[model samples]
Target: MNKKAKIAVTRKLPATVETQLEELSDAKFNLDDTPYSEPQLIRAVSWADILIPTVTDQVNAKVINAAGPNLKLIANFGVGVNHIDLEAAEAKGIQVSNTPDVLTEDTADLAMGSFIMASRRFGECERMVRAGAWTG
Candidate 1:
């Protein structure tokens, strides 16, 4: 890795991740923190050596095809890569990767919520509270 890859990040990530990416490559951040328009995505694909897209950024076949030959890697920031077109990237010889375990904490919290709701009958309690019938 003598030559640093020019990386384009599609959205605002956590500070730690931004720092790491900055250390690793010529990383560019989206300061606006908004999803890219289709034209902006196309331009990013053309301009960058690597593209770091979030779940909100849809990297479909059209965008992938618009990428320059310099574009080689698509390192998605989040768990889901369904927003990106796998076959398109493969066809263009671009490698695709993602953080699959990114939602582990979220999933665990959701599971705990479900258990607590069921065991305590929170739904019924909430209904009563909303109806002004809950004394407590």
Candidate 2:
């Protein structure tokens, strides 16, 4: 029988996603929602076939170099991969990926809202009201 692949997720993901991962693989999740310390991250990579990291986790060269042979992928949960060491992953032949478009719509909405609020001077009005400087 083929053994299920082991996956280690560094942060708390949605329950639906975690359930799916658990069903398909030997998945380990950080239910505490805290970012893994360096030693904890190293141990996860040492045994996992895949590592799911968020922006908070630093997947630097030291962590990459410590990964076992079975660790073939580092799938970042967020769009930015600044915390991960791309060069090291390349040298180690481990593929890296991220969910880039997931925040596109949300980002656009925030920008539009900010523009509207700024144009209307909402912040200034709110401050005046709070400071009791505005009436009628």
- Identify the leading candidate in terms of lDDT: 2
Work out candidate 1's RMSD over C-alphas. 2.5
Question: Each model's C-alpha lDDT?
Answer: 0.94, 0.96
The collision pairs in model 1 are: none
Error of 2 at 117 (Å): 1.9
Which residue segments of model 2 deviate by more than 4 Å? Answer: 124-136
Give the worst 10-residue stretch by lDDT in candidate 1: 1-10
Instruction: Per model, state how many residue pairs clash.
Output: 0, 0
Model 1 agreement with the true structure over 1-136: per-residue lDDT tens digits = 3988899999998889899889988988888999998899999999899999999998999999999999999999888899999999999999999999989999999999999999999999999999999996
Candidate 1 lDDT for residue 124:
97
Error of 2 at 136 (Å): 7.8
All candidates: CA RMSD in angstroms?
Answer: 2.5, 2.1
